[model samples]
Target: MKKIFAILMTVSITYFASSQSKTFPIASTLTTIDGETINSNTFKHDGPIIIDFWATYCKPCIIKYNTLKDKYAEWQKRTGVKIISISIDPASRVESAKKFVEAFEWPYEMYFDLDSELISKLNNGSKVVPLTLIYDKDFNLVHKSTGASVLYEGSAKKGVKHLYSGKKEITDFTVDLSKYFEIIDQIISK
Candidate 1:
């Protein structure tokens, strides 16, 4: 009994220490919007990188992309961070997805995960749209959120409020990009 207890304690400590130092898997291969294959490691730089998982048909995802498109340049300049937007749309919708991306004129790197390879690697099995993952300069997974609203203050609750409002529902939603920038600031400062 004493020997068994000692072995269990050793395993527990090893597991805890490993879990505490989790890093992002930057070796996964993902395709660019231009159909060029590339590895996620290409995004790693001297600063943090934000990977946004989205779908073409997802309304909230569209809102988040639009908001990010407007502020991407400023955010890049200020924080030296890069945002990689990955589309998890079906293969049949690849053309449509390209059209949508072109319409928005997003100045960030865009990729299509038709087989969900990268998404599966990042999300760990659960598939959800508008998922954002932030990785530090060393490729460590720093922050992750399921929805765009979570990136900003009160945006999620505000969307819920509009849904329950006794008036024509507002379809337009926006997030405070400054909040996201603040996150980059915090991660890079560390």
Candidate 2:
């Protein structure tokens, strides 16, 4: 009886200990355009993260995101990968960010580095628009680059596909359609 009880206790303890997920240090606290503070520290680390840095006035940024926004959800489901769009636009442009989201009708979460400190720390003092930073489940840097799309390999979707599929054969990052989502409409329809 004593032996059985001891073994059961050990198994129970180990199961509980292993089940808790470890949180990552992506964003401590992010402010929303509606004046709300959301701590991104609780992101579900089930998979890697795709962080895109952008600004409202950036034409290229808009174009890149236009491509990104359409396929955000499909990517989330296909691989459990998620995107955290961080806006570099000024605080004054906070409203613009929110308006832009509304106009485009996107469902992904949006944010801005109002203090600009997050961008500096994450990218090592290099402030650039449309920067995509990929991190592993353990909070390790996978890929970092400044461009309209994550061109480390072929395109942004390729980066996402590579991360989820675990096809290490490809040394470059690209975004493939089957592993991503896409937007179909831009003009306000009748």
Candidate 3:
């Protein structure tokens, strides 16, 4: 799988570098799955935003989604943060975006950036999936990474906390978000 993925990325990068034209262009917002407008201003009033650029076929990407979906509420309550997932699977995969959401119902938001307009700017030109970006309230790019959050939780959290509060450490992965959301649902039902 690693070899296959590496080949694909290599192919993609090569193809883009050859034919993708000049520097990548970043569009503010196009349209989300739920038909909501998600742009730079959508987070104008919010704190640090975690933008996850992913696709429905990416398993590691889904793992990150499951994690954020589970801990999202607490992340909001504890830090007033927001997670925006942008799908970059091309225009043909838009339906998968909807199906993926229904299969795993997360309270967070997901946008269909099929062409990767906004996602391209995430890394300042790299069209990498699962690249999460942490930006300050003023929209200054703080940390931009291109990997799973679980593997990079320590660093991701450190930067997140630096922007969230005076704390030295942020939340860890052992928190079990899937079960966290489940418990919250159970309490709400009570």
Highest TM-score among the candidates is held by which one?
1
Better of 1 and 2 by TM-score: 1
- Give candidate 3's whole-model lDDT: 0.60
Better of 2 and 3 by lDDT: 2
Evaluation by lDDT, superior candidate among 1 and 2 = 1
lDDT of 1 by residue, 67-109 (tens): 7777778778988888888999987998999998888787777
- lDDT winner: 1
How does model 1 fare in lDDT?
0.75
| Order of the predicted models by TM-score, top scorer first | 1, 2, 3
Candidate 1 — worst ten consecutive residues by lDDT sum? 162-171
Worst 10 residues of 3 by lDDT: 168-177
**If scored against the real structure, what TM-score would every candidate get?**
0.74, 0.68, 0.60
lDDT of 2 by residue, 45-153 (tens): 6566667777876545655665566576775676566677888777788888888778767666677778776788778888787677776655566667675433334
> Alpha-carbon error at 35 in model 2, in Å?
2.1
Please give the distance, in angstroms, between residue 3's alpha carbon in candidate 1 and its true position after superposition.
48
Model 3 alpha-carbon drift over 4 Å, by segment: 1-26, 35-42, 149-190
The predictions' CA RMSDs to the true structure, in order, are 9.9, 11.9, 19.5
